[model samples]
Target: MRLSTLVYMHKNMEKMEPLLYDVIVVGGGISGLSAAARLKQFHVKSLVIEAASIMGGRMRTHQETNLELGAQWIHGGVNANSLYNYAIQKGVLNKENKIQEDSEKGIFFYTSTGRMIDLETSQKAWEIHERIVDESENYPKGGNGVQISLKSYYEKQAKEKLKELRQVAKNKTFSGEYESDLDYDEEDLKLAMDALIIQFEAYCGDTLDEAGVAVYGTSQELPGGDVPFPSGTSSVIRELEKEIDERVMNTKVTRIEWKDDSYFISTEERPEAYRAKHVILTVPLGVLQKKSITIEPPLGVAKETAIANLRPGRISKVFLHFNEPFWIPGEGDIIFLWTKKEMEQGVKSKDWTTRVSSIHELESCPNWMVMWVSGDAAVIVDSIDDEQVLKGATRILRRFTGDPGISVPDKILRHPWLADPLTLGTWSYPSIHSKHQDYYELMRAMPSPENPRLLLAGEHVHPQYWSFMHGARLSGLEQADKIIKYMGKMKPKQNGISAAK
Candidate 1:
């Protein structure tokens, strides 16, 4: 049956019978939408309840500038990634989309003292940083019996590599290998080490000290590299929204009560309660951590423990739109390297600008530059006003580029994901106290897997793909399939028909 027809029938049936549905998904993000779409394929009566007025939770895009305000990249372009495949099939991604290569070809690295690092030295530093990152992954796969923070591991590797480089330079000088002094100084070496750490922190969406080394390489990456939607990431959400738009309701689910085989979902605005045989929760990890929704007959000790251990990571972006570009065109990215002394001073001053990872020119929108911030700085930026953020970003850009007369941005765009009640934070990260098993625990269905009443689906619950869009999409599909199989078993035996089919 067509989904529109099914939706119409369900609406009419609601008047006579109780408003019971086969499944009611809470949180209308990618995970919830995907689940609802999959259920619609099987002609299952399902409804999606979203707290926000609009769909596409974190995948928000600015209509005026066509710039993504949240969740921009389609990490892991093509390979076996379902999200990428779906975007490609839906014609949302095109040649305009750029592949994010690991090479630092067009990037310029500048020190806080207004000195740009030479291309050769910068390239060499990047190569060493990448090698160290790859090596750190071994810790999680039993390379070391004792797990440590990524910060500690990175420091150890950086020290060793720096010592080795110094020794090599000494050998070359002693042998009279024709060279004009040392290619880099001690200050330059320090900048490379510290800058790489900040870059990794931005990728993980938190400070390295808070992230566990044991979970470093647990998440798998697709082969084709990351890609961003030129039009916007929300295009993918819109595609999925088409399949289940009628089944979606804009309302906040405040409390959920499960008794026997039925579940009651209460909303903040509506007085009437919605009944369902099963509930699929796809809310963000931040929402769950905050306990924004009450789950009656509380989620057991294990699930509660998982929620407490896994932390919500903070990541925010500051977009500055310029009338004319001050820096050279085609310079892919501008990385700011802070001196140890400057970093120490900033801590005392509460300078949030020190936390910015890099400033990159948008490929699709050349006039716009994006400043990446994470960890404590992201939280600080989220709390501050836009004028303060603009001033801070301008100060950093002028200082790094040695251009004191750079004009202020005509417009600025930013989203306070950390402060936003709906999101609370950006994504999930494995804290020092978190374990790999916690993800599986989060995925476990309530009561029992054989006869499930409450199931969880979100990016945080994916064992190997946590914090990725594809992971969330896959988790939704997995839970939907579980419900279909369970319904198939529960079907009456009078006819040789299966609900799953």
Candidate 2:
């Protein structure tokens, strides 16, 4: 609906039933649902309001494509992962559709010139990957010897590696074991750098020039490996839906007027407000940063400042389904990169196809290959139409595979989370300048002059699992626990009675 229509409803809608509750959880995403489920565990009265007709938030899957359009992976399958454990315990994971580990799959790396990097060179490429991860934790010191952009640090090191290769006339270990002759030009550096940046896009949602060099693996990976869901993440949503008795769908929370331990929740659909003694906001950090929902008696400076200071990630995916797979078979996933010339020509041609992060062959489904898009190219993706996206994608695929007879994909699917009204972006990431204190500020809600009337929860603010589904889920449990302890300090407000002084 248009903004004007929302404003009109805000001005003229009749007072619907004044839905009063002990607690109201805004957002039906995992965070909110988890909070509501935990609250139910304590036998605390609670209701959930979801803006979308369905729940699961970013965990949605495309029905036709069967592609997980959001929250596509479980980084940690068991132990340390509550959500995955829940899926296992409840048998929510589809047994017919087994999860596949992305790392264990085969991967092929191709240059812009349509030449696949040999296995030996691919091993070197992995060595580069490890070097960059190390850089994420600790960047190489310049003359001044401090941290710099991955781009700058990487280029400098690449230049040095080239000099050493030329000096020795062959690729060799520093200990003097000969490996192979370095047969590369300046273009190889560009290709590797660009591909690495694209890979970071999937994780950090920022360009290499801007991403904090050492922030990549700074957060703990849940061990094991990430697995894609063939049945989609909706199973988790369906499970949460069963637990939530009061599910308010399609209610866009516009303004929340909080005062004296009570919340008057307003929505675009109704001028009438839902009153609650406490409110839990499980909205994504992007939505909160957008200030999509106004909180009357505005949040405290710390909360506002934290919201402004923290960074929200942006990413999108392109899924191309075909009659057959002409791509090479790897044990795991495939990494495709454009040659410097190919990358340049595509940009000059205004085709963003060269921007794909990775072309992942779905092991469970052979007819499809998913391409991840991120960084500046992702921004450009929003402006182009679908036909061009498919055309550009196929053109690049044929060029890399050297298969002129390869036909166009039978269908195309793209996930533009950046343009999503509800999400506004993907997960959150700590930029080069981010601090933990800001996250703390975002987590702790403003005291209502009398009681803690509001709480915030999402993957971004998670202590251990930031930017992951498990982190978001655990955050809700933590927030619910916080509220439970908070409410323990005072008696529950009886219905139709004001708890305010």
Candidate 3:
């Protein structure tokens, strides 16, 4: 059915007795849309209620430049990722969609004082960082029954490695075999540690002190590297939207009340309430944490505790569209390294520039560059004005590149995901207080799992794939299957008619 026809049907139904849908999927994001689409495939009556004016929640694209404001890359590329495979099957993504890997682009490292580090030294530092990260995968279990943060583990390893490197350099000097020009120094050690923290924050979606070390390598990754859609990430959403014909846009569900073996979903925009035999809530974890929507007969203590334990990850991007490229063509990423003194002063000064981790050239958009700010930095950047953000970005670029004459961007684009009420934040991450079982608890159906009337579906619920688009899509399909099976077990009424009908 066409959207217009669905809208017409909804309007006409609202004027009369409320129709009890078989399933009502809340939040028209990837997860909700996927669930509704799966339900439609089984010929089940379903409706998607979205608070936003358009679909594709976090997979939003900037209409003007055709650039993705959220979820720009498909993390697993074309490997075993279900979302990537689905997009390929729908013909939305093809061979041309593959993005240039980091190795393909020239990467340069620079200190805060505008001194560029040699490639050899930078490579060595990165190698050391990678080695330590790899070792985290084998972090000893049951360490005296005391939990440790990723930060603590990283610091301990880094200190030992730095000591080893310094000892080797000292031995070489004593043997009269040391080359002053090629030797690693204290400055290099500090830069490596700084870079590691910045990169880890981006990966973990929080400061090292917050994420637990136990879940360091719990999430699985696909074989292929990250890839971006040539058009935009929303291309997948467009395809999914085609499969889902019934959706009410701009309908913000304010409350969900369970009564008489059914769910009465209330919206702030309309007087009539929506009735459904089952509901699939796909809102972000952040929204649930904020209590934006009320649930009568509140979720049990176990589920509520799980919700409180999982933290919302945040990340903000600033797209600077320049009239011309300032640096060398195809420069993949320019990483900024802060000295120990600069790091100390930056903490006291609370400078936004200090929060900038790296700037990268967009392969799809040649003239555009993107600056990544994650963790607490994302919150600050999202709250500030565009002009202030641009000023700070300009200063950082000039200082890092040692180019005093670099031109400011002609246009700057950013989306405040952290500040957006609908999202509240970007994704979900395992915090120091989080446990693996918390994910299962969060997704467990209300009342009882045997009779699941209210189902939860989102990335946060996925055990092995949380914090990815594919994870969200898979969770949606899983919930839809649960609803389908539940409906299958229902017998017809005495009149040989279904209660759902």
Which is the leading candidate under TM-score? Answer: 3
Per-residue lDDT of candidate 2, residues 1-501 (tens digit): 354664464345465555677788999998899888888766678888888888999898887666787888777776567887777666766434334544455456776557876655565555666565555554432222344565565567655654554566443546576544454443454466556556755656655565445443445676656755546788777887777646667789998886655888888866546889888888888898888998877877777876775567767677778876665565325677765566567657765666676777776567887777775577677567788788877877777766687788888776677777888777777655554556666677557323557888888778667788888988888787777767673345589672221
**lDDT tens digits, residues 50-104, model 3?**
9999999999989878888888778887646888888888888886777655654
Backbone clashes counted, model 3: 0
Descending-lDDT candidate ranking: 1, 3, 2
- Tell me the whole-model lDDT of each prediction, alpha carbons only: 0.80, 0.70, 0.80
- Which lDDT value does model 1 have at 392? 92
**475-501: candidate 1 lDDT, tens digit per residue:** 998888889778883345447764321
- TM per candidate: 0.91, 0.83, 0.91
RMSD of 1: 4.1
Candidate 1, after superposition: displacement of residue 355 in Å? Answer: 0.7
When superposed on Cα atoms, how far off is each prediction in RMSD? 4.1, 6.7, 4.7
For model 1, the stretches where C-alpha displacement exceeds 4 angstroms are: 1-18, 94-104, 142-145, 178-182, 489-501
* Candidate 3 or 2, higher TM-score: 3
Model 2 lDDT, residue 246, Cα: 68
